[model samples]
Target chain A: MNQSMVKVFDIQKDDFISAGEASSSVKKILKQLGVSPEVIKRAVISMYEAEMNAVIHGGGGKGYAEFFKEHIEIIIEDNGPGIENIELAMQEGYSTAPGNIREMGFGAGMGLPNIKKHSDQLEIKSEVGKGTTLKITINF
Target chain B: MEEFINSVTLDKDKCKGCTNCIKTCPTEAIRVRNGKAYIIKERCIDCGECIRVCPHHAKKAVADKLEMIGNYQKAIALPAPSFYGQFPSEYSRKKLLIALKNIGFDGVFEVAAGAELVSAETEKRLQTENFKKPMISSACPAVVRLIQMRFPGLIDNILKLESPMQISAVMARKLFSEKFGISENELGIFFISPCAAKVTAVKSPIGIKKSAVNGVIPISEIYGLVHESLKNTEDDNQTNIFSSDIGVGWAGSGGESNALSSGKTLAVDGIQNIIKVFEQIENDKIENVVFIEALSCPEGCLGGPLAVENRYVAKSRLKQHMEEAKSEKAQIKPVLSKAITWSEPIFPSSVLKLDDDVMIALGKIEQIEKIEKDLPGLDCGACGAPNCKALAEDIVRGIAKETDCVFKLRERVRQLASEMIELESELPHTMNRTEKNEN
Candidate 1:
């Protein structure tokens, strides 16, 4: 048996119906790993928030989860226009999601900050007009 | 250790092994092998979805026979409120209760009365108890088991309280033993449940070491006796009925949520719908909700698989009856708060895990992924597994063979036939078709 497991999910752009698929799969794997409920909840919250970020703002992307003995790590990379101001984007209620997405009950500007809140450690790398890479780690 | 107890059973003689029940089960607990379908005891939640879907009427719910009541010196019937919806609206709740007394029971207890106590207790807890947000209701035993199996993380969110049935059973024994001058054990406490889950809950309870309930009888099973006994009751001579009772409303969907004053409360019913909500709650997508009432049966208890009436008809009937009774105030009183609280807490079930060791489970997960990729992905259920993924897991678990899948079996047969043809072509020149053609 390997000490760790890796799973990947491909997020389609604006696929609201399947928005939670990545987080859900990760949650199931965590449950199978006998991860504590609190840890699973935190990981799921951050995972969903980050996944939604890719869907709504990043124009779909790829998310990866690596389950380890001590902690679980999630990495999401998107090709959408990246954030020019990382500091401002980290603030609560600061979202660049379109008006249409906000009207649909999403893009409340809580995505990035909420993910940062639930994750034990969060790091984001972005370049204007290129893409964004987000990494989140939730301790078991 | 808690004994494995399940009320749902299969009548082998009637089962056609047609793979019908396996597909409808929310837990995917049923499997066909050797031309017979059997439920995996640990995975079954007794939701009775199989019983509702079996075309051959092979699935049956095991409940105590009415004749079992005669075994005790005195027996008190605790009828679920859904039972009231089974009778005509003309018959007042009191009249229906008295009819149970006529059916050889020494006394009758209304589960709704106990429900009122639970409602009061929940309101108090909502204000005082420090709990995770979106406390899920435990009124439905099927939902309790569902959380235990599939949503193990949410076990802490379950409201820590005895159900109306258990509370009514405890109260019934106290009230009846004092009235009959008998010991509690001497008095049989039987719950008239609308579903099979309650029967299992009594036999193997969670959040309690043992259930106060002595036995459970389904409403569908007891309806005949109560109906026959109803002719002897005089409805006009009965005491005043409270049509406006908050507890009585617990029979249908949203009843539990409606009875409380909790802010941002939500009620969800039906097995699949509740499963989805549970996933969302786990993901924290459903935030700001203080409580959630999830019922496994559609339309709540009124739509239980063991229920006698159509849920739609029963829903209307229940509404009209409650409306008529609304003219009266309140006769049911809340019991002591401590009396209705759960004796223990529920623990998450690990039955759904691929293995006990995380490393081993991870290895199995990898294998399952590889196998699933190769599977036909048709989810045809011809392999006796619920889906392609399930069959892959079963194969990894060593409980099933890969050839169990018809597609895989066909591929293997085709490969073997090609190999045989090639072997024949390689036969000695004297025996080979190619040698004959050259000659």
Candidate 2:
């Protein structure tokens, strides 16, 4: 049976007040679907890291979540300066965020690494001059 | 399934179907359905937030009556530590104990003594157990229920010890029965509760199959009687219970953490704040803490809805009482029994589930999301739900309709108007054809 539900959210750059809104909505949907707490927690942490990256690194972005029978996939696409090197970005404590962002206690350089650690699978596609898209999948 | 009994009840006669209670409930256990606020038994934690917020006095905590003491040959009053903070500082601890006797209890047992024992037991467990850090206190029944419903991951962190109320009831029953040579059935152990959650705890205990206390009586119900008895009597015979000031401090916030020696602890009161802290803990944000004392009520048990005194006043009075009684210490040592420890694993209540089946719940979520898109998202609470999302859920559940929202109704009216205009234009063409045929 093809049982799937999809929801999309538009996230704006530097929108500090609503930075976590998308992740919260995703968590709420997962909870309503009666997902286990462990799965929800993993999904939340992965999605939040991706959401923050979209807002902080990318100028503005769109967050999409597709809930399926076996797994949930989250896609974050952003129109900002793309990553020059994916391998370097994935390293822990490696961040290009400005000092101001670091002072806000957010850009500790663990976003991508933490996301990879929590999600079952992570995919990163980016063109240096174009934009970046992160696809995260977490199994139920 | 056994019928679920909740201590918080609604007075239908006084209910105006207001959304205040629904909004205030942390668990979203209350819903305005059929023009009345209904409590979902599985979702309700019996925190009594609705009872405190309702303006019409519709919400009430159902507890045992004072007259029920007549049912037993010997009645023991197991007063919660918070109960001591309800009265004025002029009333001595001996006077309070005597007043309880005058009010119909054969003997008085201080729950603080049990709190002292539990504190000592918890200290020992912290040193011996190799479990998770930041162990949670299970003294507040409301907090335990909240964890069961929302924070199931932290269930293992909750201390498996019985609450001070239960321990006090057991001690009281044993001491009273032995003194009078009466059977357990003939003696009643009643807890003087500071909140509705305690009443529910006594009725249907968590972790344990049954409660040690026979019944629970709200502090508000017996406050007036205790005061009257205090005024009528003279301080001739003085009786002192076996509870130190440290144990009595458990009545207010931070008391449990303070009672424990040499550990990094965090104490949080109020349901919303506790939820935030729990979320942080789940995210691995909080660390280096040995214990966490989370209370559902603001300022701890003193802020319970069933209490007679204001929370701030009670807290100050309790502080003063603690300061004055610092020299006195508990003379009795309680023996901790193995039966009081929880042996079974705690399970999640899963009250947040939309449906029992995952597929059905997923389908419902799609419908709710579709409905939510059309909603104005104003969260005005005009539709009798706490928010637009809740209204969308209610709509999908067939309890509400799209037209219930004013914005949706306006959109429907606009569509009908456009359809009427199209029919009106067609009417002119039909009239011309009829005129030509007649000619």
TM-scores of all candidate predictions against the true structure? 0.95, 0.88
Q: Name model 1 segments beyond 4 Å from true.
A: A1-3, B236-244, B329-339, B426-439
Give the per-residue lDDT of model 2 (tens digit) for B298-346: 9999999889999999998888778866877665556445216764556
Q: Name the lDDT value of residue B339 in candidate 1.
A: 41
Model 1 C-alpha lDDT per residue in residues B172-279, reported as the tens digit of each score: 788679878988899999888898999998998888878989888888887898899888887644333322557688999988888898668999999999999999
Clashes found in each candidate (C-alpha, N, C closer than 3 A): 1, 0
- lDDT per residue (tens digit) for residues A1-140 in model 1: 67788888999999999998999999888887787788888999999999999999999999999988779999999999999999999899887888999888888887888888999999999998889999999988
Give the deviation of candidate 2 from the true structure as CA RMSD. Answer: 3.7
Candidate 1's error at B281, in angstroms?
0.6
Docking class of 2: acceptable
